[model samples]
Target: MSFITLNITCSEEKRELLIAELSLFPFDAFEETETGLLISCEEADWEEEPVFAVLARYEVECRVERVEKVNWNEEWEKNYDPVIVEDQCIVRATFHEPRPDFPYEIIITPKMSFGTGHHATTYQVLKHQLQLDHKGKKVLDVGCGTGALAIMAHKRGATDITAVDIDEWCIENSEENFSLNGCDHVKLSLGGIETVQENDPFDIILANINKNVLLDQIGAYSERLKNKGTLVLSGFYTEDIADLMAEAGKFGLVHQEQTERNRWAMLALKKE
Candidate 1:
C-alpha cells in the first residue's frame, strides 16, 4: 500500500506539541528526525484538507512535503546490521553474520516492533540484568517486544519466565526468537500488564515501556512482586526519572541504580 508521507520541520521546543497534534491524523507511523517529525499515513479521504489548519490551531510552524513510498520493512532490512553491546552482547538481524566471542548473543529479526536491545532502554535493562542473580528466579517481562529481555533472563538461568507484549505481532516474533535461541522455558503472551494473572509474586520484573505506562502500573508491579523483588524499568527520557522514582517510592520501591545511554534512562529498583 502506498503511504502519504508528511514531513514537518519545526523548532525542537514545539516538537512535542506538534507530535500531539499530528497524532490525531490517520497516521500508521511517525518518526522523530533531526529537523522535525515525519508522519506517514495510508491514503485517506481527507487529502485536500490543509494540514496547516491543525498546526495553526496549535501555533506550530511546520512545512509539509511529499515523498515516494517504499516497503519500509525492506528498507529496514537493507540497513539492518549487527550491533555489539558492552563488548559482551551481540544483536543482529537474520541476514547478518554474528560475531562469535560475545559472552551473550541476542538474535532479532527486524520487524515492525521495537526492542532490538540496541535502544538505550533495552541496553540498560540487559546490562542491569547481568548484575543480578537470574539463577532459578521467576521473571516477568512486561512489554516483552521481540522477547529480547526475557530470552536473556532465561539464558541467565531463570527457571520460569513470562513474556508479554500488547502487540500480537510482537508476541509472535518474540516467541519465534525465544525458540530460535533454544529457550523453551520462557512463556509468551499477548496482552498488557493486566494480562499478568496466572503468575504472581515474581522474583524479578522487567518493564521497558514508556514513563506514563510505567507510572500508571507501578502499583500493580509492586503488588505482584515477592518481598525484596527487583524491578527494572526503562523507556523514558532522563528528565522523567524524578517523577518515575517518586511514583515507584509509593510502592516501596527504592532506586538501586540507574544508567543513561543516548539521552534515555533506566532505573533499577527493589521492593522493600
Candidate 2:
C-alpha cells in the first residue's frame, strides 16, 4: 500500500498539540520539523477532512502529498538514529548493530510509529520503567505504538503484557516488532481502553497518551489495576501534570514520582 504524508506549519506549542490531536486518527508516523510537523499514514487510511478540520482549528498551514513506490524502511533506516537513555537502554532499528554494553536493547524499525523512545514523552517513560520493578508482573501498555513500551516491560521481566492501541497500523507494526523482539506472550489488542477486558488486572499500567484521553480514562485505569499497582503516564506537557495528577487522584491513584524531558512529563501513580 502507498503512503500519504501531511505537512503542517504551526507554532511549537501547536506542534505538540496537533500531534496529540492527529494521533487519534489513522496516522502512523509523525516528525516535528523546524517549521512544523510531518505526518504519515497508509494512503487508504488517510482522511483529509478530519486532518484539515483539526488543522483549521489551530490555524496552521497544511499540505498533503501521497508518496508512491517509496521504500519507507530504507528511508527510515537511512535517517533513523538509535534512541539511547543514560547509556543504559537503547531503542534501535534492526539495521543498527546491537549494543551489548547497554543493559537493555530494543530493535524497532521506524514505520512512523510514535513510541520509539525518540520523543521526550516516550523517553521519560522508558527511563521510568528502568527504575521500576517489572519482574513477573502483569503489564498493560495503553496506546502501544510500535509496542515499544510493552517490549521494554517484557525485558524488565514482565511475563504477561497487553499492548493496546486505537490505530490498526500501530497494532500491525507492534505485532511485527513484538516478534522481532521475541515477545510472544504479549497480547496485542486493537481497540479503545473501554473495550479491553478488566477481569485480569495489571500490576503496572503504562499509558503515554494525551491529557484528554488520560483524564477520561483515569477511572478505567484505576478499575483495571491491582491494589497498589502503578500507573505510569506521559504524552503531555509538564504544565499539565497538576491537572492530570488531580484527575488521577480522584480515582484513588496517588502520585508517587515524576520525570520530565523537553517539557513533557511522565507521572507514576500507585493505586491507593
Candidate 3:
C-alpha cells in the first residue's frame, strides 16, 4: 500500500517532542534525517488536520507527499547496521555477517517497526536484561517493536514470552523477526496490555513506549506483575523519571536502577 509522508523540519531540541506528538497520530514509521524527520502513515489512515495541528503546536515546518510502495527490506538493508551490547548480545539484520563471539544474537528485519537495538532505550534494556535471570521465567514485552526484546528474552531462556504491540505493522515485523531469530516459543500478539488475560501475570515486563502511554498503563502493569517481579521502562526523558517513579510507587513498585543515553532514560522497577 502507498503512504502519506510528512517531512517535518523542526529545531533539534524539539525533534523528540515532535516525534512523540506525531506518534499519538496514525503515523507508522519514522526516520531521522540530518535536518528533521521523515514520518509516514498508511494513506487510508492519514489525516491532514492532526498532522498540521502537531506541527503548529511545535511551530515546525513540514512538507507532505504521497509515497509509492517500495522494497522496505532492501532499503533497510542498505542503511541498517548491527548493534552489539556489552559484547554479550548482538542485534543484526539477516544480510549482515554474524559475530560468533557474542553469546546471544538476534536477527531482525525492522520494516517500519522500532526497537532495532540501535535506539538507546533498546540498548539499555538489553544491557539490563543481560543482568537479570530470564531462564524459565514468564516475560511480557509491551509495545514489542521488531520483537527484539522478546526474541532476546527467548534466547536468554525465558520460557513463556509474550510480545504485544498496538501497531499491525509492528506485529507483522516482530513475527518475522521472531522467526528469524528462531524464537518460535515467543507468542506474538497485536494489542495493548488489556488484551492479555488477567489470569496470567508476568515475572518480567518490558515497556519501551512513550511517556503518556506508560503513565496511562502503569497501574495495569503493576496489576499484571507477579509479586516481586521486574518492570523495565523507557522511551522517556531522564527528567520524567521522578514522575514515573512516583506513579509506580503507588503500586508498590520500587525504583531499582536507571540508565540513560542522549537524555533518554530506561528505568527498572521491582514490584514489592
Candidate 4:
C-alpha cells in the first residue's frame, strides 16, 4: 500500500517529543533526520487534522507528500547500514557479508519494523544486553520491534523468551528475523503486555518504547517483574530520565544505572 510521508523540520530539542506524539497515531515507521523526523503511515490511516494540529502545537515546518509503494528491500539496502555495538554484537541485514570477528551476529530484514540497532536507543539497549546474564531466564521483550532484543536474549541462552508488540507487521517481521538468526524458540505474540498471562512473572523485561508509553505502563511492568528482576527502558531523551525515574520509583523500582548516546538515554532498573 502507498503511504503518506510527513517530513517535519523542528528544533532538535522537540524531536523526541514530536516522535512520541506522532507515535500515538497510526504512524508505523519513523526515520530520524538531521533537522527533524520523517514519518510514514498508510494513506488510509492519515488524518490531516491531527497532523496539522501537532505541527501547529510544535510550531514546526512540515512538508507532506504521498510516497508510492516500492521495493522496500532496495530502499533499506540503500539506506540501512550494519551497526556494531561495543565490539560484541553486529546487527546486519541479509545483504551484508559475515563478520566473523563479532561474537553475536544478527541478520534482520527490516521491512516496516523499527529496531535494527541503528537508533541510539536500540544501540544502548544492545550494549546493555551484552553485560546481562540472560542464561535460562524468563525474558519479556515489550514492544518487540523486529524482535531484535528477543533474538539477542535467545542467543544469550534465554530459554523462555516472550516478545510482544502492538503492530502485526512487527510480529511478522520479527518472526522472519528470528528465523534468519536461527532463534525460532523465542515466543512471539501480537498486542501489548496484557495479551500475555500474568500468572508467571518475568526475570527481566526489555521495554524500548517511548517515554509516554513507558510511564503509562510502568505499573504493569513492575507488577509483571519478579523480585529483584531487571528492567531496561529506552526510547526517550536523556533529559527525560529524571521524570521517568520518579514515575518508576512510585512502583517500587530502583534505578540501577543508565547509558546515554547522542542525547538519548537507556535506564536500567530493578524491582525492589
Best by lDDT: 4
Which candidate leads the pack in TM-score? 2
Q: Which stretches of candidate 4 lie over 4 Å from their true place?
A: 1-69
CA lDDT of each candidate?
Answer: 0.77, 0.86, 0.85, 0.87
Please give, for residues 1-272, the per-residue lDDT of candidate 2 as tens digits.
78898767777557667877888898766765556677788999978887788888999998788887456566565556788988889999898888899999998965756777777888898999998999999999999988999999999999989989988878988999999999988989899789778898999999988898999999999999999999999988899999998888788999899987767888999998
lDDT per residue for candidate 1 within 112-183, as digits (tens), equals: 456776456777888888788999999999998778889889878899898889888788788788888888
Residue pairs in candidate 2 whose N, alpha carbon or C atoms collide under 3 angstroms: 29-112
Model 4 poorest ten-residue lDDT run: 70-79
Backbone clashes, candidate 4: 0
Clashing pairs in 1: none
Tens-digit lDDT track of model 4 for 1-272: 78987778877557667866887899876755555676778999999997799889989999888877744456456556789999899999998899988999989887657788877899899999999999999999999989999989988889899999999988999999999988888889899978877779999999999899999999899989999999999999999999999999999999999999889999999999
- Report the Cα RMSD per candidate: 4.4, 3.8, 3.7, 3.6
Clashes of each: 0, 1, 0, 0
Using all chains and alpha carbons, the TM-scores for the candidates as numbered come to 0.77, 0.82, 0.81, 0.81
lDDT of 4 at 262: 83
**What TM-score does structure 2 among the candidates reach?**
0.82
Tens-digit lDDT string for candidate 3 (192-239): 999987788999999999889999999999999999999999989899
Model 2 CA lDDT for position 245? 82
User: Cα miss at 15, model 2 (Å)?
Assistant: 5.0
